[model samples]
Target chain A: MVQINFAKREINCKLVYYGPGLSGKTTNLEVVHKKAPASKKGELTSIATEGDRTLFFDYMPLELGKVGGMNTKFQLYTVPGQVYYNATRKLVLQGADGVVFVADSQPDKMDENLESFQNLEENLREQGLDPKTIPMVLQWNKRDLPNVLTPEELDAKMNKYGAPTFEAVAVTGDGVFPTLKKLAQIVLEKLNREYGLQNDGPGGGSAPAKEPPKEKEPAKAPAAATPPPKKPAAEPPPAKEPVREPAKAKAQDDRAERERAERERERERERAEREREREKDRERDREKEARPKPRDFNVTPPAQEPAKKGGGKGVLLLLLLIAVIGGAVGAGFAGKLGPLQKHYDDHLRQHLGGGTPAGQ
Target chain B: MAMKPSDTDQKLRKQRLIFYEDDIGRINKALENYQNLSKSRCNMLIDVEGHPVTQVGSTEGINLETIAALVAASFAATKEVAKILGETEFSSLTHQGKNESIQLSIVGDRTILTTIFDSQDTTVGMVMFYTKELVEKLNAIFNEIKSRKDSGKPIFNDDFKDMSGVLDDMFGDV
Candidate 1:
């Protein structure tokens, strides 16, 4: 999810790097963290095992200081890629604005790469996210490996959506920024398409409508391959000059003036409504404070009380019991209940205990 | 199970959070008051999905962004744990440390209020007392913000081509 805060003048987006184990998912983050300017990058935090494999996730916050007058921050995360950590991966994938799939280029890792990609799709579906619609890029990592598969073979097997793919050696930082840049670009473009000034409607409700057209004009230049200089000088002044006849130009100007005045009136009305709402809120707060109410430190909020009041607990207990019995029966049928169940229980306990407290 | 179209749309809408200047001002004011009353070192309001909304107090040595992500993940994992334990969910969680402790409480349906305070300065009881009151106020504010039909105009222009330059500036020669 993208968060836009007008008061703070900040925009925050979450981008997740996902792939199979040992595929350089964390390496990409490490390279970005090491190479990114000190002022722009936060400390990279990783929850890993003694073997240095990710156990939960790796997180790093990148601040793009200010872009187009808004403080843009990207929180980069990499999920534990081993198959047993599916739960952790799903948790990390929740509310991701974009994703970067880092696939290993080794021929032997192809099966693992394909399996991880499928797992990513399944998780996206579970979260009600369309894998096709979400902004994503594929990075074929470890290109420097001696027996690496070619990019075309990797793409044929994995790029089902045909997303923008990059070839990279993440350990040495070959194409990390390009991959990240492409993903960020598409993500920002998606955000702009969804919430840009064009959605403000035909009334020209705000001043932003007038500026986007001018900024968009240079995007249509013939030399699109060349980077468009962001200077007012680049915009042709004569094109905007009044070329219409005096009568028509004057009439259009008059209509524009009326629209401007109408917008101002609308703004004033909104301001007045906001003032009323603020006052109402203040009054409610005062009333709440004045009223005598008993507080229970252990009790949940009123909104959550109904769930507890209902027979939800009983049903959940029944379900848990059934699950335990079913697990025991199945394990007995397999004739390896003891060792497998013990390993499963130990793994569950370790993840549950160590994964939650991400504080120092 | 596959989600219905309407359900998916509603879920997506819930995922996005846009804060106008007015909402930000009110939320910040409330957070500042909570921080003062609770005597906490820092207070952060983060969405259930882990995006940091706002914060107050001194966060000089902390990696708040990391904390926000981890806290949300922890809360989510705990929700799953509660389900396994025959409970609906845990509304609040506290982690006690030798010197510094943290409290995380759910606010409204979509956000969490995380307070990191000195264990010696204030007791958990005091923090929980103030949190109960602040949560109600925040819920009301969030409901009002949600009910708003017109939340001003969009500030971002349609031109995203300049993002390349922005990226280059941030990650030079990397």
Candidate 2:
């Protein structure tokens, strides 16, 4: 489905590249990503495995500045080509506005191409899309290789609805852009026919009517567009007004219905954005709560070592040890001095005469 | 000759979505509620075809474009798993991780809601609960969009004068 952003004056559409394994679906995207101007292309992202096989898909958003009157952007995607990846392929096919089926051109690969085409049809059916109606382009890739089925042969087998087909050597960038241009043209035409929309620009309502066959020749472009312009002057009203009048009324009704629905969605987006802002504020508050605080010192003492500083208790212990040793040495020296011994004996006899007589 | 059921149904089906100014607000509200409730790192509203419609939240380091594509692929694969197991389909799928996880569920039939969250900050239970509620809200909105009647007039009956120029500029002489 195409999304129109009136606020940005932009239109976004999805286009997928699908094929059997190694059929150059990814190569087509690689060429476009390589050749598209830097300004016109977004980053090319590939979600592949170690062997470089696309596991999920490849994505690139190309900006076509402005078409009709709005900024038109095309998102290109490629599904994994393996048959076992059918689930993934169906997923990528969902809501696709357009598709490009890149077929392997080798003669032996014909069966694979047919199988892939059937797969595409079945997948489109599951998504409620008709392969007959969806704007799809066929690319006969690896055209530069040998023993490949010719474009006509491949088209007969795979393009049952006669979608625009292209012959390409995707690795060399040949036919890639032409195929894309054709697809975009058809997609836009489909949008215009179904939704009353043309890319936003000059000749907005006047251009598509002049080239009706262009839609059929989506496979051959740059050349397909060479047809002479039709009654450009008389065609404006009959071409634009009559079609637009009934469409405008219906468009307005559609717009009303769409508006009602989009309004609710818009409100949800705003509410979510506001909630995100508030959540960020709450996260900041939590961080503040977890921060260190000076008040914590009141609960537990500050971490400084008093023992390592060697203060009052250490000095008192050293002084006590020195006094005990000095007393013991002095007693031994007094015993060895005779004069000092006689004085000591006189004092002993006076104080303890009864104890001395018992000793004698 | 009898036409197939799809051929007849195609005439009445609308293939595109049209938005007015007010619709943006409602979409935001639903997405905002989900992000808040889940505390997700990011949220993306994508069509089943892997196109991103709108996104919100902390999308840093996330390549939303790639995420949108892969989410659809993985979800589709999971649906196949359910079919193989004899079930109709899985309602939702969550890919858990040590630090981050992603939850994917359909909003209506055409859209998918993808949410990426951090397990360290929020629980999977919170993400699943809010995601389910958000899907219901979004489903209501998408149903309306899907039901819109389209005007059958050709949008650009005008010649594709600009298309050639675009192609030329994008792929010069290719």
Candidate 3:
């Protein structure tokens, strides 16, 4: 999960290291924790047995500095990789934004690797996450060990979704940071796409789009002719904008005022959202009341209220049909109405003639 | 409207864990109180996922990291045992040793409160009694932090750079 707290200006993301038992999932986290500076990393917590098999999981929170104007923190968790601990594994997989599957490279551990991969897929499916779409990286650990499968072989078996893969020893820290770095970049890119932010690649590529890159591109022209042309193409608009630099400052001030207004609107929206949620709870209650048809049909009055409201249009249509049928039947009796009118006229004439002698 | 599957997933992923200086101050205060009342030598507030959220008391020469991890694992294993026995969960676990004893209790939904004391100095009953109050106080602090809706802007702005520099320093010359 990538949590963005606008109020706090913080972005928190969870990355889980998953693999079979004894596959160095814990070791991967330990290496990163040991290597990460104190300022950048928090205390590494591991819940394992005396035998050092992780019982629950190992957690390390790393601050990867600011990106996209938010301080990004990655909470790294490694699930208990043993097969018997599948329940715990499922619990930890609940809200993962990205995953690093650490596959054991030893030949004997192939079955475990396959089984864990299957478990990961099943768990992700159960969580309603598409295994293919979630950002993932594969690390084939214990690469330094003899009689290990090649990276190609490991990928052939386990990397079904073709996530970028890395070869790692994990214990002596071989390929540890790169695995983390690549995963971080992929996850960040995933978020950038999700939130509609431009991909500011690991290097702050967009910020220096105008000046420094142009000078550097010319310097690298002898080595590669391809680099210089792209920046030169995008530079013209920015190059012409220096005359508007004074206005840019004013625009920045306006942006600040707009941001304050946005914050106020955000708070208002949040209050309205809470009200909506409360209303939804009432709706859910009514739905429950309407669910038991036979028993609650008479007992609950509101249950019938929805049916009436929903059927109101149908009821109106039925009444219109009846009215049209009645009109058609009256039209069929129009000839009968003419004869009755003649009989009434003859009766009226007889009464008036009696008063004035019949012949006259 | 029913949420789309991806939207629901995004909602699940969106958990903001912000610990500002105020939160740190409250946590340290509670730990101090817990230590004084329980006569515990050292105490730690650890997340259930096996990470230390904060710690207080004398942790000199103690590998608190390893202890926290093992304690969480042991507590989880015990909870599983309780489930097998048809118990919902045991609120607290106390281990008695010749010289030292450790008490572990659940704090909120995702954290563990651990207190270590010498058996001669403090009894389990005393520790448990004080820990109950500590949990309540800590829970309030956490809830307040979670519900905080401050409108002020964050200090870091365009002046911030070198996120990768932090990582570089972390892995430098290793």
| Top candidate, metric DockQ | 2
* Cα lDDT of model 3 by residue, A171-248, tens digit: 898878767765675566555433331222333233211111111111112222211211111111222211224366
Q: Residue-wise lDDT of candidate 2 within B1-174, one digit each (tens)?
A: 111224523542355555433455577667866675565777888766566777766666887766776777677778788999998778788899998898888877666888888775467776885677678778888777667654343333344346556656766633
Candidate order by decreasing lDDT: 1, 2, 3
Candidate by candidate, in order, the iRMS in Å equals: 13.0, 17.7, 19.7
Interface DockQ of each model: 0.16, 0.20, 0.04
Tens-place lDDT digits, model 1, residues B9-34: 34665557878656866887788777
Candidate 1 CAPRI level: incorrect
Alpha-carbon shift of residue B124 in model 2 (angstroms): 2.3
Second chain only: TM-score per model? 0.85, 0.84, 0.80
lDDT of 2 by residue, A298-328 (tens): 2222332343245675554455445444654
lDDT of 1 at B105: 95
Off by over 4 Å in 3: A1-16, A21-82, A87-98, A104-112, A124-135, A141-157, A160-162, A169-174, A185-360, B1-9, B149-161, B171-174
Model 2: how far residue A80 lies from native, Å: 3.4
